[model samples]
Target: MYLRLENISKRFNSFVANHNISFSVDAGKIHGILGENGAGKTTLMNIISGLYQPDTGKIYLEDKPVKITSPKGAIKLGIGMVYQHFMLVPQLTVTENIIMGTENSWCLNLRQKQEEIAALSQAYGLKIDPAAQVENLPVGTQQRVEILKVLYRQAQLLILDEPTAVLTPTEVESLINILRQLAGAGKTIIFISHKLEEVINLCDTVTVLRRSKVVATTIAKEVTPQQLAELMVGREVVLQVNKSASVPGKVIVSVQNLSVANDRGIPAVSNVSFQLRAGEILGIAGVDGNGQRELADAIAGVRSIINGKIEFNRSCTRQKIGYIPEDRQKIGLVLQFSIAQNLILKAFKNLPFCHHFLLQPPAINNHAQVAMAEFDIRATGEDIKVSQLSGGNQQKVVLARELAGEPNLIIAMQPTRGLDVGATAAVHSRLLVERDRGAAILYISTELEEVMAMSDRIAVIYRGEFVAILDAEIATIEEIGLLMGRGTGGRKSAGTG
Candidate 1:
């Protein structure tokens, strides 16, 4: 059905999340939304999905105004939304999850419902096992289950929020095809994502929101990726990686036949050997849960290495290394701490941040002031809590704290995982800056495109082993992908970048 929003506005306390937002989407078409973090994309989506009541606005469905005050009301009106985070119970089967809250009575026929759900899954090209538990399925399969949940409810308009964020490259391709099939079947879809190319390729119309307002809405085929980026950020944003040639220095760290185990005491990283030199960025690329975290944790002295040895060069001590973990909210910063306190976490007992066995508040605050300005952290003040900042600003706090003294080695793991395009660029710029400052950086990420662009030498990791390490400029996408899937399939020797 056709949907329209007129003069949509929402406010939380004194902050306006969405202001005078207006847009119209035709039925049986994929519409894409683009915006930076805190640009009101999520707020607008919440309003559409009936999680929020607009302070002032009118929502029109088929040119008729309707009140959607609760999620049940939205469902009754044939609207459904799948968030970035999966809302499935791991212990439940796919059939159980899809039919939740829709059961007619207490007498439930489990096997019969599973068969029905299986057919529904097959019809949409989902190919999911309705009887299998959700905990046993892959990330992409779980995503398909989410979409199936909405379809099973007979939703006419589906709003997907960053559906492809956690999916692997292969899974992403599958999801794209599934979404195309849905749109072809006359389902109105609103796709929200940070991937500009995917949006342009999938959506018929693209709308951009900036600073809580609808800035531009244009046909997807008529706009370029750079143009959409600029419209979203309200400025000319650089979507490319800008870095100088790496001039390698002395070896900073070397892992010889290193092996690591996962949390369940299972061998995750096999006998892997590699050396990283100063002033170089070596990127490890693979699918998620491919021993990336275990290896990084071992190198950072957090996890135990079951076998082999990790040798650091002179002056590369635990205190001289900067570690930016993938889980920034939990691992990178202390949520209760202020920006000033978190900035001095690594050096709290040192001279400037501490004196005479007491914490130096003035010095810590002074350092935070400088770091916030340099890192471009947009917050009200230095004393503001880290949890109060946006995702981008919180990441900036972690970067500021970790890269304070230019550590000799930097371990950056998925540094820009959930950030917007602008914040991603900032993190890339900072890491490149550290690399230029004679620091060896081990960049671990599941994002293949980002890994290829940021690394001097790209390491294809599969099953906890580096199948091939090719020079970034010479590494072909097909070769890397082959190595990532089948170990040693397209072997490329370690190149001198």
Candidate 2:
């Protein structure tokens, strides 16, 4: 075995993050650690990468036990980790970022280091400009720079956490190819992801972790996606959403000639128009970096549009639209607040919990308790900090809070991005229920399967344009894939706006 974790365990206060987990990976192979959000997968990888000291356990590299007390120690032992969030300084150039901590003198060896970085990028099929600033690069290229940072450090074992969560389908395929090439060149890869299809396609072996324990490990080729889902959740998994056909009613939201600019002052969405009806779920599918973010933000009243008209239904006069942003930490909820506090974010001012000038703490707690119970949020109490909950449970809090407002429209962006099988199912069920109750939903996601399964009508967004709209019942994966590519010779369908 190239790497073996023997009885690794960790705890924080009274919560056991990792419970005596054991697993091993071979040399020059891609080993996947599969688990739901907060299933101790990150904790295990952090322990091996020296970010945390395990309460009890040993890590073996090449069958030799080593004590990795810090990140620097792990680097010296040939173990490197790339975090879910990129670590590069935004203002630094690519070459500077890669050679930030090198031993060579900057004044004397700057040119040589630049050459080395260029050579490494070429060798790994990462076409990145060395002089480009990190902030100016696309997310896909930034990811490549992260990989280059680890490779430049001469790491033999690379641990990646949720590497493709924000990537488009095309970029995801490129990443899989890159990993395969790295493994082909005798590097060991420990990939952590929640996407089952990607895991089955890219990994040689898979280890399933559930609630801080390794439940099963098997060859990736021998297991189906269903089997892997079952192993990860410890039950029979249903990969499909069960929703009856919807007879969409009157328009809930109408957008006319909407246009929005990107961060660089370029038009990211141009002259886009659509109508969302009550009792209907309209899914927008697209590659990452498309206008999905801008479009969703425009509809949710978060972003100012250059030219547009937005009309919400008359019944929703009391409650504004609810928006579940793609980056939960940045826009969805306040991580430092408690569950009870976050539950009152938008509705605090206009509630029974507010009386003239005083806030009613007891009423707020009561509302929070009811939400937690209804949503099955696994938190200790209303006083427990939101950040203390697992990623899945944190998402549940966001969902519970937003849905409790009884909004007429819900703009859910990547709602189930990093959730495990059970949580994904729960989210799907909630959306279906909302649809049945006549709430208009705008579901924006990079996962085509999800868009196809839950939507009544599907719109494909490509490069600042709504390229095509098709009925969900008639759209095939191949059709959507072609639309995503925006190639020269694919069937172009008309918009149903």
**Top candidate when judged by TM-score against the true structure:** 1
The whole-model lDDT of each prediction reads 0.90, 0.86
lDDT of 2 by residue, 1-497 (tens): 89998999899888888998888999999999998777788888888898999999888899999898999999988898988789999999999898788766536576777888899999988889888899888677799999999999999999999898766566777888999999999999999887888898999999999888889989998999899898888888787799999989989898888899977888999877788998999999887778989898888877888997888788765365778888777788899999999988887886677889678999999999999999988887998989888777888888998888677898999998778888898889988998898889999998788999999988888777777777898888877876876622345654545
Candidate 1's clash total is 0
TM-score of each candidate structure, all chains considered together: 0.94, 0.90
Off by over 4 Å in 1: 485-488, 493-497
- How much is the lDDT of residue 379 in candidate 2? 85
Model 1 alpha-carbon miss at residue 267, Å: 3.6
What is the model-wide C-alpha lDDT for candidate 1? 0.90
Model 1, 1-497: lDDT tens digits are: 48999999999999999999999899889999999889999999999999999999999989999999988899989899998889999999999999998998889999999989888888888898899999888778898999999999999899999888766676788899999998888889999998999999999998899889999999999999999988888778889998899999999898988999999999999988899999999999887778999999999999999999999998899988899999888899899999998888888999888899998888889899999999999988999999888889999999998887789999999999878889999999999999998999999987788998999998877888878888898887777766765666765577433
Pull out the clashing pairs in model 2: none
Minimum summed lDDT over a 10-residue window in model 1 is located at 488-497
